[model samples]
Target: MRTAAELKYGEKGIINDIDGSHPSSRRILEVGFTPGQEIQLINMSAFRDPIAFSVRGTIIAIRKDEASCIKVL
Candidate 1:
């Protein structure tokens, strides 16, 4: 498994699991990042702070810190 943030440009994967107990995890799940959904790494800034991705057919941008808590396979 790998982190959502670890996906390179144009990489794609299913949301295998979320591996944290933080409240952010619940919020992430609520945002259509549930297990078994597909996600694609769309782009990243020069600093790679906020990474862009397609989640459940919608493009969403998340901070790298939040992406680290999302596991994909």
Candidate 2:
């Protein structure tokens, strides 16, 4: 499994598992990023700072660092 940001643009994947501890992991869950959920990499800037994605049918923008914590299948 890889991170959501690691996914190529327009790529889609199901959430497999998160490789992190509490708080950050808990924060992701609170935002609807759960195991088995679908996610898509929408867009990225030239700097590749905040990557956008569609998660649980909602468009969400997050930093690459945060996306790295999320493991995708």
Candidate 3:
């Protein structure tokens, strides 16, 4: 039940689900973070507010708040 935000740098995870009620859920999905997708933490900002993830052949940067809504394992 861990969230994407909880994944350590360079760790990989499978997307379990994204909170449908979250405002950024749609945007997240559009970026290829759909359920069952494989994702990896690629980078993080200096303050760790925004984190970069590798998924579906591309890198995506999302705020920590929005990332927390994405459950992973």
Candidate 4:
């Protein structure tokens, strides 16, 4: 039940499920945050609001609140 926002720097996890209740869920999925996809916590801001992740060979940065909707295992 760990969320992407909880991942430590350099930690990796497989995407389990996405909270469709979130307004940006569809956009997140469209960009590659799909179930079964592997994601890594590559970087985070000093405040940790916008975190960067490596998924599908690309690095993407997302907000902590938005990342909370991503369930990871």
Q: Supply every candidate's count of residue pairs whose N, Cα or C atoms clash at under 3 angstroms.
A: 0, 0, 0, 0
Model 3 — which ten-residue stretch has the worst lDDT? 23-32
Top-down lDDT ranking: 4, 3, 1, 2
lDDT of 4 by residue, 1-73 (tens): 9999999999999999999999989999999999999999998889977999999999999999899999999
Task: Give one digit per residue, the lDDT tens place, for model 3 in 1-73.
Answer: 9999999999999999999999999999998999999999999999987999999999999998999999998
lDDT of 1 at 3: 92
Model 1 lDDT tens row, 3-68: 998998899988899966755887888888888989998989888879988987788888888898
Q: Answer with 3 or 4, whichever has the higher lDDT.
A: 4
Clash list (residue pairs), candidate 3: none
Candidate 2, which segments miss by more than 4 Å at Cα? none
Residue 40 lDDT, candidate 4, scale 0-100: 100
Better of 2 and 4 by lDDT: 4
Task: Tell me the TM-score of each prediction against the true structure.
Answer: 0.88, 0.86, 0.96, 0.96
Worst 10 residues of 1 by lDDT: 19-28
Which one is best on lDDT? 4
TM-score of 3: 0.96
Q: Candidate 1, after superposition: displacement of residue 38 in Å?
A: 0.8
Global lDDT for candidate 1? 0.86
Give the per-residue lDDT digits (tens) of candidate 2, residues 1-73.
6888699889999999876663477788888888899999888878887888899889888888888888998
Better of 1 and 4 by lDDT: 4
All candidates: CA RMSD in angstroms? 1.2, 1.6, 0.6, 0.6
